[model samples]
Target: MQLPDKKFVPVMITPFNLKAKVDLDAVSRLVDFYLAAGVKGFFANCLSSEMYSISEDERLDLTRHIVRYVKGRAPIVATGSFGLTIEDKADFTQRIYDTGIDAVILITGHYANVDDDDDVLMRNFDRMLKLTGDIPLGLYECPAPYKRILSAPVFEKLVATNRFVYHKDTSIELEQVKAKLAIAKNDPNLEFYDAHTPNAMHSLQMGARGMSSISGNFYPEILVWMCNNASNPDKQEEVKWLQAELSAVDPAIHVAYPMSAKYFLRKRGLPVRTISRAHALELTPQQKQTLDEIYDRFTGWCDKLDITPVNVEELMKPLIHLDPPI
Candidate 1:
């Protein structure tokens, strides 16, 4: 499976039913929606997918299901390990690879108790790689439970091994991003994906490979459009405005977390329920009002990009329900 080009790769959410079970039906619809929207690829079983809340077996099953569902139309990268032990993590990673995903993403702090020590972390990483035997890997600087930002030297060291192919950079610091890009420049295998939407345009300008922001869950095509047009001298002004629009997404939708995202997806007509086991379902009236404004603004921006959102009826027509005998 080839990796997706430098474009919008969404860290996709697992759509659950009202009962909070893994809804394959919803998953099918979402895949179609993403494909229709021109997402370059998918990042599955990440924090947005509630990987921490899900059991190992469930994560494996879901990863396999999505791989099968996509049928290789786009490359797939998945969060492969969250195990406390190196052996366990390697085992899980091997299992995830067996499912035929293109690459595996590892949280930076997974095997370490202390984030300050680089040697310990690198040693643990090397040990895990030894067991997994040359499967491609990506790093996610996910800031949940805790954040372990990779230092420049350690990052260079890891990339030197050539096993690290993709990086989900969440440093949120432009200087650091620049430094990382410099390190990445010499290595063809290394590509950095900026997770910070506010810094996306600048990062792209600085030679980052692509985007892996939460906003892709809602407006992947817009992100794709921005990335494609960001370098055009004539499109500078238009791209600047869209950058602000993209940056505003985190504040509005991230406020409600995975819940707000699910709600927004439902609004876009994907068959997803707002049920998240990782977060509370409660949204205050004021929050709902804020969400409403965000939705309206989002729709306006979509129009500005000349992107039409898919409706539920359109997506569900192929499988329209049959009448139940009562």
Candidate 2:
């Protein structure tokens, strides 16, 4: 597979289903939707998609289906997360790499207290690198409960190995972004992407490179445009204006990220649907209102980009019933 262009805005997909099943139709429609929206690529099984909740067969099934659906229109990256064994990571990655994906995102596997000892972390990283060979892998730097934050020195050492090329920093804190920026700025091959849209501009200005975020999953056009303007001093105000639109939505309403995103996509003239997997977080009345407010703001911001958001009821129908029964 060819290399993914640096300017591409990869939307982290959040698969959803009202019945708590993987909505495969919605997934294909979404792939087409983002491609039309001018997205450079897509990342499946990432946080926005709730990776750990889905089974391995589901992951591979999604990847294979999408690879055939996408047909190389844009690079599709499979997220490397099993939350299990290192061998599991290698085996899964090798299998996915065989599926013709351009790259695989290697996040820290399911382990705890690994961060305390840099040796253990490096051992894992090096082990992955050796197994991957020249498959073109990246790192999803998510410092969550299940995964350890690769320290600066440890990260630098891993990147220096040249096995990994892209770094998606999902660590939400700005200081962490800054710290990663400080380290990533020197590595020329490392393509640093800030998953935190709140600090996207600062990261771009700091010479840290581009972004790939969950928020981008909805507004692929705006996200790609923002990256294009990262180096342009004239577009600073424009980028700031767009980023503000994303901020108006409540960040906590992740229960239905796909629901929220597809709501807007259907509005934008796409055939995509909203679906979620089993074990998804259930939202309350206030949460529903919060999501409503987010789409409200999203529609408002749509005007700024000339995208007229879809009607709420139309999308709400599909959100409530992902697949029209077997």
Candidate 3:
């Protein structure tokens, strides 16, 4: 359950072919891309991957492919909270864990309805823990279904279980983030990751293990740099500057996302098609223009920071044919 310090785990986006099927080849390339960008781990089959859009068998297949393709280069975790009941969720948890993932992540919304109190949520979580045995687990406050932001009390209670090891916090509010971190900051067994890009610097300073924001999907290298230097005394000025730059465009990258991310990566020369099952509509010219501008800014950041962005062309060299046609 222990990951490296200041890790940048990307909430992976699924790559689909023209027919909207999972493109395993593109997936392999994407893994290479993330690893080259210095990501410490991968959060596969999560919201960015369009978990709700893909079929149950596809989920297992996709996650299995990532686990096999990664080949233990970095730890991998995926969502396991699906189905109508806790028992059903527990069943899938075991199934996905069998796929060789380091841990099974449970969506907070799956445990209780939007209106349900924390007590109800805790009861279901306790039930899930009991049903699933000692399999490592994580929590994600997924926006879909309804984001169930855990209260500080609830988070402390869950941390006490010692069954949970990873937490992806989407509270967004710094106060709430600080409160939760106060409880988890001391737990070596738990690694807290902030999902809000704007809160990245503060959260990391306040003791977040690393970041797993959607921003990583666009420019993982920037996020990786931030994680590596967020708290360094010598880097505070640069960190402050980079934090402002990232916060300024946080909303821009989120517009038409997963698609925006695919478009951005395509601009970086990846083979990912701008096809997303979650977002069926195509990006408008305006959206594309905005992302293009962001792409320029991303390059400028890399130059100013002396971070050499990953060369997608070189990264894909092994996949290309170099022999001249006869």
Tell me model 2's lDDT, rounded to 2 decimals. Answer: 0.65
* lDDT tens per residue, model 2, 116-175: 577777777777667767888888766444556666677678777877667887667777
The RMSD of every model to the true structure, in order and in angstroms, is: 3.6, 5.0, 3.4
Q: Please tell me which model should have the higher TM-score, number 2 or number 3.
A: 3
Candidate 1 minimal-lDDT segment of 10 residues: 317-326
Candidate number achieving the greatest lDDT relative to the actual structure: 3
Alpha carbon lDDT of each predicted model: 0.82, 0.65, 0.93
> Which 10 residues in a row give candidate 2 its minimum summed lDDT?
317-326
Clashing pairs in 2: 16-275, 16-276, 17-275, 17-276, 267-310
Strongest candidate by TM-score: 3
Rank by lDDT (best first) = 3, 1, 2
Model 2, residue 315: distance off in Å is 14
lDDT of 3: 0.93
Clashing pairs in model 1, backbone N/Cα/C closer than 3 A: none
Q: What TM-score, over all chains together, does every model reach?
A: 0.93, 0.80, 0.96
